[model samples]
Target: MAATTALDTLIDLTKEALDQAARLLAGERRTQQQVLQQLQTLNQYRLEYGQRLQEALQQGIDPASLLNYRAFLGSLDNAIERASQTLRQQQQKVDNSQRLWQEQHRKLNSYDTLVERRQQTVMLHASRAEQRASDELSARMSRNGAALLPPSDQSA
Candidate 1:
Protein backbone atom coordinates (compact mmCIF):
# COMPACT_ATOMS: atom_id res chain seq x y z
CA MET A 1 0.00 0.00 0.00
CA ALA A 2 2.75 2.40 0.84
CA ALA A 3 4.44 1.62 -2.44
CA THR A 4 1.22 2.19 -4.26
CA THR A 5 0.79 5.54 -2.58
CA ALA A 6 4.30 6.54 -3.52
CA LEU A 7 3.71 5.51 -7.10
CA ASP A 8 0.46 7.46 -7.18
CA THR A 9 2.27 10.56 -6.01
CA LEU A 10 4.93 10.06 -8.63
CA ILE A 11 2.30 9.55 -11.27
CA ASP A 12 0.60 12.81 -10.29
CA LEU A 13 3.86 14.69 -10.50
CA THR A 14 4.63 13.17 -13.89
CA LYS A 15 1.19 14.12 -15.16
CA GLU A 16 1.71 17.72 -14.07
CA ALA A 17 5.08 17.82 -15.77
CA LEU A 18 3.54 16.38 -18.93
CA ASP A 19 0.81 19.01 -18.88
CA GLN A 20 3.34 21.80 -18.53
CA ALA A 21 5.38 20.41 -21.39
CA ALA A 22 2.29 20.22 -23.59
CA ARG A 23 1.44 23.84 -22.88
CA LEU A 24 4.98 24.93 -23.64
CA LEU A 25 4.95 22.98 -26.89
CA ALA A 26 1.66 24.58 -27.90
CA GLY A 27 2.97 28.06 -27.19
CA GLU A 28 6.12 27.38 -29.15
CA ARG A 29 4.11 26.10 -32.12
CA ARG A 30 1.92 29.20 -32.06
CA THR A 31 4.95 31.43 -32.04
CA GLN A 32 6.46 29.51 -34.92
CA GLN A 33 3.24 29.86 -36.88
CA GLN A 34 3.18 33.61 -36.22
CA VAL A 35 6.75 33.92 -37.40
CA LEU A 36 5.93 31.95 -40.56
CA GLN A 37 2.96 34.23 -41.28
CA GLN A 38 5.11 37.30 -40.83
CA LEU A 39 7.69 35.90 -43.19
CA GLN A 40 5.04 35.14 -45.77
CA THR A 41 3.64 38.68 -45.49
CA LEU A 42 7.10 40.14 -45.94
CA ASN A 43 7.68 38.04 -49.05
CA GLN A 44 4.35 39.10 -50.55
CA TYR A 45 5.08 42.77 -49.89
CA ARG A 46 8.51 42.49 -51.45
CA LEU A 47 7.07 40.85 -54.55
CA GLU A 48 4.49 43.62 -54.97
CA TYR A 49 7.09 46.33 -54.51
CA GLY A 50 9.36 44.70 -57.09
CA GLN A 51 6.46 44.60 -59.54
CA ARG A 52 5.79 48.29 -58.94
CA LEU A 53 9.44 49.11 -59.52
CA GLN A 54 9.33 47.23 -62.83
CA GLU A 55 6.23 49.18 -63.90
CA ALA A 56 7.90 52.48 -62.98
CA LEU A 57 11.02 51.57 -65.02
CA GLN A 58 8.86 50.80 -68.06
CA GLN A 59 7.24 54.25 -67.66
CA GLY A 60 10.70 55.97 -67.74
CA ILE A 61 10.69 57.32 -64.19
CA ASP A 62 13.17 60.06 -63.10
CA PRO A 63 16.58 58.83 -61.94
CA ALA A 64 16.04 60.15 -58.38
CA SER A 65 12.70 58.37 -58.07
CA LEU A 66 14.24 55.17 -59.39
CA LEU A 67 17.07 55.42 -56.84
CA ASN A 68 14.56 55.90 -54.02
CA TYR A 69 12.57 52.89 -55.12
CA ARG A 70 15.71 50.79 -55.36
CA ALA A 71 16.81 51.89 -51.87
CA PHE A 72 13.41 51.08 -50.43
CA LEU A 73 13.41 47.73 -52.17
CA GLY A 74 16.82 46.94 -50.74
CA SER A 75 15.58 47.70 -47.24
CA LEU A 76 12.55 45.51 -47.79
CA ASP A 77 14.80 42.71 -48.94
CA ASN A 78 16.88 43.06 -45.77
CA ALA A 79 13.76 42.93 -43.64
CA ILE A 80 12.60 39.83 -45.43
CA GLU A 81 15.94 38.12 -44.86
CA ARG A 82 15.82 38.93 -41.17
CA ALA A 83 12.30 37.64 -40.94
CA SER A 84 13.35 34.42 -42.64
CA GLN A 85 16.17 33.97 -40.15
CA THR A 86 13.80 34.59 -37.29
CA LEU A 87 11.40 32.05 -38.70
CA ARG A 88 14.14 29.45 -38.83
CA GLN A 89 15.10 30.11 -35.22
CA GLN A 90 11.48 29.90 -34.15
CA GLN A 91 11.10 26.62 -35.98
CA GLN A 92 14.06 25.20 -34.09
CA LYS A 93 12.48 26.24 -30.80
CA VAL A 94 9.25 24.58 -31.79
CA ASP A 95 11.04 21.37 -32.63
CA ASN A 96 12.86 21.36 -29.31
CA SER A 97 9.62 21.99 -27.45
CA GLN A 98 7.91 19.18 -29.32
CA ARG A 99 10.64 16.75 -28.30
CA LEU A 100 10.38 17.81 -24.70
CA TRP A 101 6.65 17.29 -24.71
CA GLN A 102 7.02 13.85 -26.21
CA GLU A 103 9.57 12.87 -23.59
CA GLN A 104 7.35 14.06 -20.78
CA HIS A 105 4.43 12.16 -22.30
CA ARG A 106 6.47 8.98 -22.38
CA LYS A 107 7.47 9.41 -18.77
CA LEU A 108 3.87 9.87 -17.76
CA ASN A 109 2.87 6.75 -19.66
CA SER A 110 5.58 4.74 -17.97
CA TYR A 111 4.47 5.86 -14.54
CA ASP A 112 0.87 5.12 -15.38
CA THR A 113 1.75 1.60 -16.43
CA LEU A 114 3.65 1.03 -13.24
CA VAL A 115 0.76 2.25 -11.12
CA GLU A 116 -1.68 0.06 -13.00
CA ARG A 117 0.47 -3.01 -12.46
CA ARG A 118 0.81 -2.24 -8.77
CA GLN A 119 -2.94 -1.89 -8.39
CA GLN A 120 -3.48 -5.18 -10.18
CA THR A 121 -1.03 -6.90 -7.88
CA VAL A 122 -2.72 -5.50 -4.78
CA MET A 123 -6.12 -6.57 -6.02
CA LEU A 124 -4.90 -10.05 -6.81
CA HIS A 125 -3.41 -10.44 -3.32
CA ALA A 126 -6.58 -9.15 -1.69
CA SER A 127 -8.72 -11.54 -3.74
CA ARG A 128 -6.55 -14.50 -2.84
CA ALA A 129 -6.67 -13.60 0.86
CA GLU A 130 -10.45 -13.33 0.75
CA GLN A 131 -10.72 -16.65 -0.97
CA ARG A 132 -8.56 -18.29 1.66
CA ALA A 133 -10.64 -16.83 4.46
CA SER A 134 -13.88 -17.96 2.84
CA ASP A 135 -12.55 -21.48 2.40
CA GLU A 136 -11.54 -21.66 6.04
CA LEU A 137 -14.92 -20.38 7.17
CA SER A 138 -16.72 -22.93 5.03
CA ALA A 139 -14.59 -25.73 6.42
CA ARG A 140 -15.15 -24.58 9.96
CA MET A 141 -18.91 -24.39 9.47
CA SER A 142 -19.02 -27.89 8.00
CA ARG A 143 -17.04 -29.33 10.86
CA ASN A 144 -19.19 -27.58 13.48
CA GLY A 145 -22.41 -28.62 11.77
CA ALA A 146 -21.36 -32.21 11.53
CA ALA A 147 -20.37 -32.30 15.19
CA LEU A 148 -23.73 -30.82 16.21
CA LEU A 149 -25.55 -33.67 14.47
CA PRO A 150 -25.99 -37.22 15.81
CA PRO A 151 -23.48 -39.78 14.40
CA SER A 152 -26.28 -41.67 12.54
CA ASP A 153 -27.61 -38.37 11.06
CA GLN A 154 -24.12 -37.24 10.08
CA SER A 155 -23.58 -40.51 8.20
CA ALA A 156 -26.87 -40.03 6.37
Candidate 2:
Protein backbone atom coordinates (compact mmCIF):
# COMPACT_ATOMS: atom_id res chain seq x y z
CA MET A 1 0.00 0.00 0.00
CA ALA A 2 2.78 2.44 0.82
CA ALA A 3 4.56 1.69 -2.41
CA THR A 4 1.35 2.28 -4.30
CA THR A 5 0.90 5.69 -2.68
CA ALA A 6 4.46 6.65 -3.52
CA LEU A 7 3.98 5.65 -7.14
CA ASP A 8 0.82 7.75 -7.34
CA THR A 9 2.75 10.77 -6.10
CA LEU A 10 5.44 10.24 -8.70
CA ILE A 11 2.80 9.96 -11.40
CA ASP A 12 1.30 13.28 -10.34
CA LEU A 13 4.69 14.93 -10.53
CA THR A 14 5.24 13.56 -14.00
CA LYS A 15 1.89 14.91 -15.17
CA GLU A 16 2.73 18.36 -13.84
CA ALA A 17 5.99 18.37 -15.74
CA LEU A 18 4.17 17.32 -18.89
CA ASP A 19 1.62 20.14 -18.49
CA GLN A 20 4.32 22.77 -18.13
CA ALA A 21 6.06 21.50 -21.24
CA ALA A 22 2.82 21.70 -23.22
CA ARG A 23 2.30 25.33 -22.23
CA LEU A 24 5.83 26.27 -23.20
CA LEU A 25 5.45 24.59 -26.57
CA ALA A 26 2.21 26.47 -27.22
CA GLY A 27 3.85 29.84 -26.61
CA GLU A 28 6.77 28.99 -28.87
CA ARG A 29 4.43 27.75 -31.63
CA ARG A 30 2.50 31.00 -31.54
CA THR A 31 5.64 33.10 -31.89
CA GLN A 32 6.94 30.93 -34.73
CA GLN A 33 3.63 31.16 -36.59
CA GLN A 34 3.70 34.96 -36.46
CA VAL A 35 7.24 35.02 -37.80
CA LEU A 36 6.23 32.62 -40.59
CA GLN A 37 3.36 34.86 -41.66
CA GLN A 38 5.55 37.94 -41.76
CA LEU A 39 8.10 36.09 -43.84
CA GLN A 40 5.45 35.06 -46.37
CA THR A 41 4.18 38.61 -46.78
CA LEU A 42 7.69 39.96 -47.27
CA ASN A 43 8.46 37.31 -49.91
CA GLN A 44 5.38 38.32 -51.89
CA TYR A 45 6.37 41.98 -51.81
CA ARG A 46 9.85 41.07 -53.08
CA LEU A 47 8.35 39.26 -56.09
CA GLU A 48 6.12 42.20 -57.00
CA TYR A 49 8.97 44.70 -56.74
CA GLY A 50 11.22 42.56 -58.94
CA GLN A 51 8.61 42.45 -61.69
CA ARG A 52 8.10 46.24 -61.57
CA LEU A 53 11.85 46.85 -61.86
CA GLN A 54 12.08 44.44 -64.81
CA GLU A 55 9.29 46.28 -66.71
CA ALA A 56 11.01 49.67 -66.21
CA LEU A 57 14.35 48.29 -67.43
CA GLN A 58 12.79 46.98 -70.69
CA GLN A 59 11.49 50.48 -71.58
CA GLY A 60 15.00 51.95 -72.31
CA ILE A 61 14.95 53.75 -68.95
CA ASP A 62 18.61 54.67 -68.21
CA PRO A 63 19.56 52.02 -65.65
CA ALA A 64 22.14 54.52 -64.18
CA SER A 65 19.50 57.10 -63.30
CA LEU A 66 17.38 54.22 -62.02
CA LEU A 67 19.62 54.33 -58.88
CA ASN A 68 17.48 57.31 -57.87
CA TYR A 69 14.64 55.66 -59.74
CA ARG A 70 14.57 52.18 -58.08
CA ALA A 71 18.07 50.88 -57.49
CA PHE A 72 18.21 51.85 -53.81
CA LEU A 73 14.67 50.61 -53.41
CA GLY A 74 15.68 47.32 -55.05
CA SER A 75 18.57 46.92 -52.64
CA LEU A 76 16.28 47.43 -49.66
CA ASP A 77 13.82 44.94 -51.18
CA ASN A 78 16.51 42.29 -51.64
CA ALA A 79 17.65 42.73 -48.03
CA ILE A 80 14.12 42.21 -46.78
CA GLU A 81 13.87 39.08 -49.00
CA ARG A 82 17.04 37.66 -47.45
CA ALA A 83 15.77 38.42 -43.96
CA SER A 84 12.54 36.60 -44.76
CA GLN A 85 14.48 33.52 -45.85
CA THR A 86 16.44 33.54 -42.60
CA LEU A 87 13.27 33.82 -40.57
CA ARG A 88 11.77 30.90 -42.50
CA GLN A 89 14.75 28.73 -41.60
CA GLN A 90 14.48 29.71 -37.95
CA GLN A 91 10.74 28.95 -37.93
CA GLN A 92 11.38 25.52 -39.37
CA LYS A 93 13.80 24.79 -36.53
CA VAL A 94 11.24 25.91 -34.00
CA ASP A 95 8.62 23.63 -35.56
CA ASN A 96 10.97 20.68 -35.34
CA SER A 97 11.71 21.48 -31.71
CA GLN A 98 8.00 21.56 -30.91
CA ARG A 99 7.50 18.14 -32.50
CA LEU A 100 10.33 16.67 -30.44
CA TRP A 101 8.90 18.13 -27.25
CA GLN A 102 5.49 16.61 -27.98
CA GLU A 103 6.97 13.19 -28.64
CA GLN A 104 8.92 13.28 -25.39
CA HIS A 105 5.80 14.24 -23.47
CA ARG A 106 3.91 11.27 -24.90
CA LYS A 107 6.68 8.88 -23.95
CA LEU A 108 6.75 10.14 -20.39
CA ASN A 109 3.00 9.69 -20.05
CA SER A 110 3.29 6.14 -21.29
CA TYR A 111 5.95 5.38 -18.71
CA ASP A 112 3.83 6.86 -15.94
CA THR A 113 0.94 4.60 -16.90
CA LEU A 114 3.20 1.58 -16.75
CA VAL A 115 4.36 2.52 -13.28
CA GLU A 116 0.79 2.85 -12.09
CA ARG A 117 -0.08 -0.59 -13.46
CA ARG A 118 2.86 -2.22 -11.75
CA GLN A 119 2.08 -0.56 -8.45
CA GLN A 120 -1.48 -1.81 -8.58
CA THR A 121 -0.29 -5.28 -9.34
CA VAL A 122 2.00 -5.25 -6.34
CA MET A 123 -0.81 -4.15 -4.01
CA LEU A 124 -3.07 -6.87 -5.37
CA HIS A 125 -0.46 -9.53 -4.67
CA ALA A 126 0.06 -8.30 -1.12
CA SER A 127 -3.68 -8.43 -0.38
CA ARG A 128 -3.99 -11.90 -1.84
CA ALA A 129 -1.11 -13.20 0.26
CA GLU A 130 -2.62 -11.80 3.47
CA GLN A 131 -5.95 -13.43 2.76
CA ARG A 132 -4.34 -16.77 1.98
CA ALA A 133 -2.43 -16.74 5.26
CA SER A 134 -5.57 -15.98 7.22
CA ASP A 135 -7.41 -18.85 5.54
CA GLU A 136 -4.62 -21.31 6.37
CA LEU A 137 -4.66 -20.31 10.06
CA SER A 138 -8.44 -20.82 10.28
CA ALA A 139 -8.15 -24.28 8.75
CA ARG A 140 -5.45 -25.30 11.25
CA MET A 141 -7.57 -24.18 14.20
CA SER A 142 -10.56 -26.30 13.02
CA ARG A 143 -8.41 -29.41 12.67
CA ASN A 144 -7.03 -29.07 16.23
CA GLY A 145 -10.45 -28.42 17.85
CA ALA A 146 -11.10 -32.10 18.62
CA ALA A 147 -7.98 -32.38 20.85
CA LEU A 148 -9.10 -29.41 22.95
CA LEU A 149 -12.69 -30.66 23.45
CA PRO A 150 -13.97 -31.63 26.97
CA PRO A 151 -13.15 -35.03 28.58
CA SER A 152 -16.81 -36.07 28.56
CA ASP A 153 -16.13 -39.01 26.25
CA GLN A 154 -13.58 -40.43 28.76
CA SER A 155 -16.15 -40.41 31.64
CA ALA A 156 -18.78 -42.20 29.51
Candidate 3:
Protein backbone atom coordinates (compact mmCIF):
# COMPACT_ATOMS: atom_id res chain seq x y z
CA MET A 1 0.00 0.00 0.00
CA ALA A 2 2.79 2.39 0.73
CA ALA A 3 4.34 1.54 -2.62
CA THR A 4 0.97 2.04 -4.23
CA THR A 5 0.74 5.51 -2.75
CA ALA A 6 4.13 6.39 -4.10
CA LEU A 7 3.27 5.14 -7.56
CA ASP A 8 -0.02 7.01 -7.43
CA THR A 9 1.82 10.24 -6.75
CA LEU A 10 4.21 9.53 -9.61
CA ILE A 11 1.31 8.85 -11.95
CA ASP A 12 -0.30 12.14 -10.99
CA LEU A 13 2.87 14.00 -11.76
CA THR A 14 3.26 12.26 -15.08
CA LYS A 15 -0.33 13.12 -15.99
CA GLU A 16 0.30 16.74 -15.20
CA ALA A 17 3.36 16.72 -17.40
CA LEU A 18 1.39 15.08 -20.18
CA ASP A 19 -1.29 17.74 -19.94
CA GLN A 20 1.30 20.49 -20.20
CA ALA A 21 2.81 18.87 -23.26
CA ALA A 22 -0.61 18.62 -24.88
CA ARG A 23 -1.28 22.29 -24.23
CA LEU A 24 2.01 23.26 -25.76
CA LEU A 25 1.27 21.14 -28.79
CA ALA A 26 -2.07 22.85 -29.15
CA GLY A 27 -0.42 26.24 -28.99
CA GLU A 28 2.12 25.26 -31.60
CA ARG A 29 -0.58 23.97 -33.91
CA ARG A 30 -2.51 27.18 -33.49
CA THR A 31 0.55 29.21 -34.40
CA GLN A 32 1.14 27.03 -37.44
CA GLN A 33 -2.45 27.50 -38.51
CA GLN A 34 -2.14 31.26 -38.21
CA VAL A 35 0.98 31.23 -40.34
CA LEU A 36 -0.77 29.17 -42.98
CA GLN A 37 -3.65 31.60 -43.00
CA GLN A 38 -1.25 34.44 -43.54
CA LEU A 39 0.41 32.55 -46.35
CA GLN A 40 -2.94 31.92 -47.99
CA THR A 41 -3.86 35.60 -47.73
CA LEU A 42 -0.56 36.60 -49.26
CA ASN A 43 -1.03 34.22 -52.16
CA GLN A 44 -4.53 35.50 -52.78
CA TYR A 45 -3.37 39.07 -52.74
CA ARG A 46 -0.49 38.29 -55.08
CA LEU A 47 -2.84 36.60 -57.55
CA GLU A 48 -5.25 39.49 -57.52
CA TYR A 49 -2.43 41.98 -57.93
CA GLY A 50 -1.01 40.04 -60.83
CA GLN A 51 -4.42 40.02 -62.53
CA ARG A 52 -4.67 43.78 -62.05
CA LEU A 53 -1.18 44.23 -63.43
CA GLN A 54 -2.10 42.29 -66.59
CA GLU A 55 -5.22 44.42 -67.01
CA ALA A 56 -3.20 47.57 -66.57
CA LEU A 57 -0.57 46.43 -69.12
CA GLN A 58 -3.30 45.73 -71.66
CA GLN A 59 -4.44 49.34 -71.13
CA GLY A 60 -0.87 50.66 -71.74
CA ILE A 61 0.54 51.09 -68.18
CA ASP A 62 3.69 53.17 -67.46
CA PRO A 63 7.15 51.45 -67.17
CA ALA A 64 7.72 52.71 -63.63
CA SER A 65 4.38 51.32 -62.42
CA LEU A 66 5.16 47.91 -63.94
CA LEU A 67 8.61 47.78 -62.29
CA ASN A 68 7.11 48.67 -58.95
CA TYR A 69 4.49 45.94 -59.27
CA ARG A 70 7.17 43.35 -60.11
CA ALA A 71 9.33 44.40 -57.14
CA PHE A 72 6.43 44.31 -54.73
CA LEU A 73 5.39 40.89 -56.00
CA GLY A 74 8.93 39.65 -55.44
CA SER A 75 8.81 40.93 -51.90
CA LEU A 76 5.50 39.17 -51.38
CA ASP A 77 7.10 35.94 -52.60
CA ASN A 78 9.90 36.30 -50.07
CA ALA A 79 7.43 36.93 -47.28
CA ILE A 80 5.48 33.85 -48.29
CA GLU A 81 8.65 31.79 -48.26
CA ARG A 82 9.62 32.93 -44.79
CA ALA A 83 6.13 32.33 -43.46
CA SER A 84 6.16 28.81 -44.93
CA GLN A 85 9.46 28.04 -43.20
CA THR A 86 8.08 29.28 -39.90
CA LEU A 87 4.98 27.10 -40.34
CA ARG A 88 7.14 24.05 -40.97
CA GLN A 89 9.14 24.73 -37.82
CA GLN A 90 5.99 25.15 -35.81
CA GLN A 91 4.67 21.83 -37.15
CA GLN A 92 7.87 20.13 -36.07
CA LYS A 93 7.49 21.57 -32.61
CA VAL A 94 3.92 20.27 -32.48
CA ASP A 95 5.08 16.80 -33.47
CA ASN A 96 7.76 16.78 -30.80
CA SER A 97 5.31 17.92 -28.17
CA GLN A 98 2.83 15.19 -29.17
CA ARG A 99 5.49 12.55 -28.83
CA LEU A 100 6.47 13.84 -25.43
CA TRP A 101 2.87 13.77 -24.23
CA GLN A 102 2.42 10.25 -25.51
CA GLU A 103 5.46 9.08 -23.62
CA GLN A 104 4.25 10.61 -20.39
CA HIS A 105 0.81 9.07 -20.86
CA ARG A 106 2.35 5.68 -21.41
CA LYS A 107 4.41 6.00 -18.27
CA LEU A 108 1.37 6.95 -16.20
CA ASN A 109 -0.63 4.06 -17.61
CA SER A 110 2.16 1.64 -16.71
CA TYR A 111 2.13 2.87 -13.13
CA ASP A 112 -1.62 2.50 -12.97
CA THR A 113 -1.32 -1.04 -14.28
CA LEU A 114 1.21 -1.92 -11.63
CA VAL A 115 -1.02 -0.58 -8.92
CA GLU A 116 -3.95 -2.61 -10.21
CA ARG A 117 -1.92 -5.80 -10.29
CA ARG A 118 -0.66 -5.20 -6.78
CA GLN A 119 -4.19 -4.68 -5.49
CA GLN A 120 -5.33 -7.86 -7.20
CA THR A 121 -2.51 -9.83 -5.59
CA VAL A 122 -3.41 -8.46 -2.18
CA MET A 123 -7.05 -9.36 -2.65
CA LEU A 124 -6.15 -12.90 -3.74
CA HIS A 125 -3.99 -13.42 -0.66
CA ALA A 126 -6.72 -12.14 1.64
CA SER A 127 -9.28 -14.43 -0.01
CA ARG A 128 -7.06 -17.45 0.44
CA ALA A 129 -6.44 -16.66 4.08
CA GLU A 130 -10.14 -16.27 4.77
CA GLN A 131 -10.88 -19.56 3.04
CA ARG A 132 -8.25 -21.36 5.10
CA ALA A 133 -9.68 -20.05 8.35
CA SER A 134 -13.20 -21.00 7.37
CA ASP A 135 -12.10 -24.52 6.51
CA GLU A 136 -10.36 -24.95 9.88
CA LEU A 137 -13.39 -23.75 11.79
CA SER A 138 -15.65 -26.12 9.88
CA ALA A 139 -13.36 -29.07 10.56
CA ARG A 140 -13.21 -28.30 14.29
CA MET A 141 -16.99 -28.01 14.52
CA SER A 142 -17.43 -31.37 12.81
CA ARG A 143 -15.01 -33.04 15.22
CA ASN A 144 -16.74 -31.54 18.27
CA GLY A 145 -20.17 -32.59 16.98
CA ALA A 146 -18.96 -36.17 16.46
CA ALA A 147 -17.52 -36.31 19.99
CA LEU A 148 -20.87 -35.22 21.48
CA LEU A 149 -22.83 -37.94 19.64
CA PRO A 150 -24.15 -40.92 21.65
CA PRO A 151 -21.94 -43.99 21.77
CA SER A 152 -22.95 -47.24 20.03
CA ASP A 153 -25.22 -49.43 22.26
CA GLN A 154 -24.47 -52.91 20.68
CA SER A 155 -22.16 -55.16 22.82
CA ALA A 156 -19.08 -56.79 21.30
Ranking by lDDT: 3, 1, 2
TM-scores, all candidates, are: 0.86, 0.61, 0.92
Candidate RMSDs in order: 2.6, 5.3, 1.6
Instruction: Name the regions of candidate 1 deviating beyond 4 angstroms.
Output: 153-156
Model 3: residues with Cα > 4 Å off, grouped in runs: 154-156
**Weakest 10 consecutive residues, lDDT, candidate 3?**
1-10
Per-residue lDDT for 1-156 in model 2, tens only? 787687677667767776777777777777777777766777677677667777888876675866755765666577677777767777776777677678767867787778878979889999999999999998889878867987677656
- Please provide, for model 3 over 37-120, each residue's C-alpha lDDT reduced to its tens digit, 9 standing for 90 to 100: 998999898898889889999998899999999999899889989988988888898899889888988988898888889989
lDDT of each: 0.89, 0.75, 0.90
Please report how far candidate 1 places residue 105 from its true position, in Å: 1.4
**Cα lDDT of model 1 overall?**
0.89
Candidate 2 off by > 4 Å: 1-6, 62-65, 68-78, 81-89, 92-107, 130-156
